[model samples]
Target: MRDRIVRRVILPVAVAAALSAVAGCSLSGGTGSHKGPAAPSGSAAGRADPQAAAALRGVEQATVRAGSARIESATAMGGMLSLRTDGALGWSGDPVGTLRITYTGGQLAATMRALSSTSLEARLLPDAYYAKVGDTFARRLQGRHWIRYGYGDLAALPGGSGAYLTDQLRDTAPLQPVRLLRACGDVRRVGEETVRGRRTTHYAGTITPAALGGADAAGLRERLEQAGVTRESVDIWVDDRGLLVKKVERGELISGRMSATAYYRDYGVKVSAGRPPAADTADFRELLSTRGS
Candidate 1:
């Protein structure tokens, strides 16, 4: 009876966690908001510059609290994450482990793992962290923990870094069309929304890049699809400053079971910006420089 329970329940739970890691990583960053004018029919007729379009979709810096996030995967399972600026991060439906991130500046990092059904072990260190599942070293890097854990964990970190990366890529000016050609599968203006009482424009799209900055493009794409990248929806809330105040996402894996939502605040972040993930350009360079044998 004990073995059976562990196999049917515990093992599946762990697998879900592993899968969550993948989905969560991609969905991390800002919340989705605002609906913009329709993209022109052809690439030639549309706003030729994506950066300016992105800037037009940005928000200003401010601090917000009482944030919540949830994710569902089509194949394995689903999970949710919540946080209050003054309180600890909370999670539900966690399988492998629970992860909590700490943010000091615009940059963020952490270490997380599954402890049990209702509990997790997390160390949100800003500079460097060590992660392991059982005895296996999961990751040890100067990169963002979200990049390491996949998408689920990425949904919990502070700042809107994930959204930042996506927007940066999606809105690359002059070559916005080119950027979209190679970096994304499709783009659209979802609509508008109210984020923290502020009206903003919203946008959604898919990332089908040949290679992620730090992952196996093919394998990662499969993982993302399993985690709900099929109709991968990204909502960006853009204000005057062009800063992403909120980013919302709904990811579906194999069976489309896991979905997540995250909101960011305390913008104009100057502290953590120069730290790890953001500051460590050299680290990313090294990772990319590695020969893929």
Candidate 2:
């Protein structure tokens, strides 16, 4: 009974929790080879307004240069999970940060409590994520309290979508709105607005399969397709310094409607993450192996 519950129910919920953290961290598009934002050359540029294009590129460059920021986000993944996360993330050319994630409500929330509690402390590194589970889960793991999930392992999970999820985590950052703007055929500035008491310029655009067709478009297209979205709407608020202050993504998925809203502040903040003690941590894969034995 314990093994069956752990394997069938707990593992999936745990994976979802880790994925929720990743997904909630950044609402941006996939990571590409380019170090900074540059206008897509050739015919693609012809379709976009030169002024709008320049504004987006400026936002991307300024964001990347800012390094890190405090982030607060709320994400709903169809009916699978809904979560709110608050923490700081650093993307100074690498994905590294920390977040305090809470499972407000969802089907996965019930199972999450079985392993630990609804709240989890997540440490994000360049290659993996470490989550701190509770004493209840620790008792079953020979006293280990942390579960380590490597990005490569996430890609090899039971479903093919695991790879897509892994890619999202790897490519996502606070500056993701700028990445989405790169694929927009018609990006327009919706004038200036106030976001959290700060004046910011609003930009809105739609992403379609047709707009994404270039050397750097493959990864972005794959991410959109995996989300079951033919078209996704993106809106962003950027401060005068060209930093992303807020972003929202809305789209239709096979399961249902999906959306996320994120607010960023305190740019250029110093942040750091340390690995859990190996001796006191367990790999998620090994935990599942105990099933049915």
Candidate 3:
């Protein structure tokens, strides 16, 4: 009976945590406000402040040039999940890194106590994300300490947004927020501010997926709409070196309010990740189908 209860509570929590992580790492969100134009429905052709646009473009190019950075981030998804992730991310090609994710609060945190775990290590690769389980659940998992979630398989998830998440996971870099804000076409320099003791120029704007360009623009819009992401306010802090030092994204998700704050530093930092041993890893999709494998 206890095993049954454990299975029921733990699986859902895992799913919730995974999905929230998807949204959190997914490209493009920001916080704070500005006097930008109202978010457009389906066009990035809205009147744009050319000067601000150029400035952000410079930031985007600078960030892209740096290639990698150490990131510390906190994310909240309604009342379902709250986590802090610390790691380094490299984005020259596909993003790859390892992060220690600690459950800070919310439902998932409470349920994680069932396994005596409130934290996990996530390794992000080009095609999948791997979760490392601690010893508490390793015994039950047949000494399997890793669970693999393929981005391709996640696309098959119920909501269409899962596909969007898949795409973002494969292609997004830390500089993605800058590109998204540039797509907003009305981004503005919000003045100067100090972030973590470093002087930075603040920039903020509001955007909708439909108002964005690039491949799959329409599909991205539709998926985000399904997720209840209509408009997101984005704030980025750039240091004198023209790199993103801090960013905050705030918006409403289907579940409720969703927000994230991330700080970046040590640009050009070497980032590394390696796949967990195949023999000791479980595919989460397979586990879901085979009654937790």
Top of the candidates by lDDT: 2
- The estimated TM-scores of all candidates read 0.38, 0.82, 0.79
Q: Which portions of model 2 miss their true places by more than 4 Å?
A: 1-49, 213-215
Candidate 1 C-alpha error for residue 143, in Å: 30
Q: For candidate 2, lDDT tens digit of each residue in 211-267?
A: 774455776676666655555667788999998888877655544555678888999
lDDT of each: 0.31, 0.67, 0.67
Global CA lDDT computed for model 1: 0.31
lDDT, candidate 3, 1-293, per-residue tens:
44344443444344333433332333222222332333332224344666777887788788779888887778776666677877776778886877777888776677666566678887878878877876777666677888787877777867465566566555435555676677765577777889899999887777677677654456546645655676676778889888888887777554456677888889998888999999999786765564433
Counted clashes in each candidate structure = 68, 0, 7
Error of 3 at 118 (Å): 0.5
For every candidate in turn, the CA RMSD to the true structure comes to 14.5, 7.1, 5.6
Q: So what's the TM-score on candidate 3?
A: 0.79
Which 10 successive residues of model 3 have the least lDDT summed? 26-35
Compared with the true structure, the alpha-carbon lDDT of candidate 3 equals 0.67
User: How should the candidates be ordered by TM-score, best one leading?
Assistant: 2, 3, 1
> What's model 2's lDDT at 42?
22
Which candidate would rank higher by TM-score, 1 or 2?
Answer: 2
- True-structure lDDT of candidate 2: 0.67
Q: Clashing residue pairs, candidate 3?
A: 30-233, 30-234, 30-248, 30-249, 30-250, 31-248, 31-249
